[model samples]
Target: MDTLNSKKVTRRSFLKGAALLASIAVVPAAITSKDASAAAKATQAAMQYQDHPKGKLECSNCIQYIPGKTAKAKGTCKVVEGAISPQGYCLAYAPKA
Candidate 1:
């Protein structure tokens, strides 16, 4: 009788532990899927800005622009990759609001 009860308890504990591990694994996968989707959207937007258009539009006046860490270095854009110029413009350009 005692041996049978112990085996039941051990099996229940094992199942509980497995459920906890599965939940932990699932949470990260869900979060990563959201991140991947957002990354894809940003990449698609960047692709549209391949050429900087000519006009008064520039990075300094755009919302996605990030000023350089130093005065000599070029700035960057949220939708555009690589070093970006303050005077540069692209299709993703959006006036600061």
Candidate 2:
């Protein structure tokens, strides 16, 4: 009777499997949950609020107005330099003052 008794798993293989499992477990979190979406929508609504039919909130009035702190990864507006509010309705509405 011959039996295979010494088939051990390598460290590399174990590490790879562990990493794969870890990534799989975190994929859902990384894929933007419902709460995250709601927050994003709220922010968007906050910044989209214009005074008139052809006006804008700009960044000076935004609650989240972080001058020199906003970026492409923050929101959709390219005029402001920081993360302005979506419903941020301001009087000035300057470009980036």
The model with the greatest TM-score is: 1
> Per-residue alpha-carbon lDDT of model 2 for 14-88, expressed as tens digits?
999999999999988977685565454343334454423344444444443443444423343333333444444
Q: After superposition, how far is residue 53 of candidate 1 from its true place, in Å?
A: 7.1
Overall local distance difference test of candidate 2: 0.49
**What lDDT tens digits, residue by residue, belong to model 1 across residues 19-85?**
9999999999999998876564344245555335458777778898898987546877787767777
- Lowest lDDT 10-residue stretch of candidate 1: 44-53
Backbone clash count, each prediction separately: 0, 9
User: Cα deviation of 50 in candidate 2 (Å)?
Assistant: 4.8
Candidate 2: misplaced stretches above 4 Å? 1-6, 33-40, 43-50, 53-60, 65-97
**CA-lDDT, candidates in order:** 0.74, 0.49
Off by over 4 Å in 1: 1-4, 8-23, 30-38, 41-53
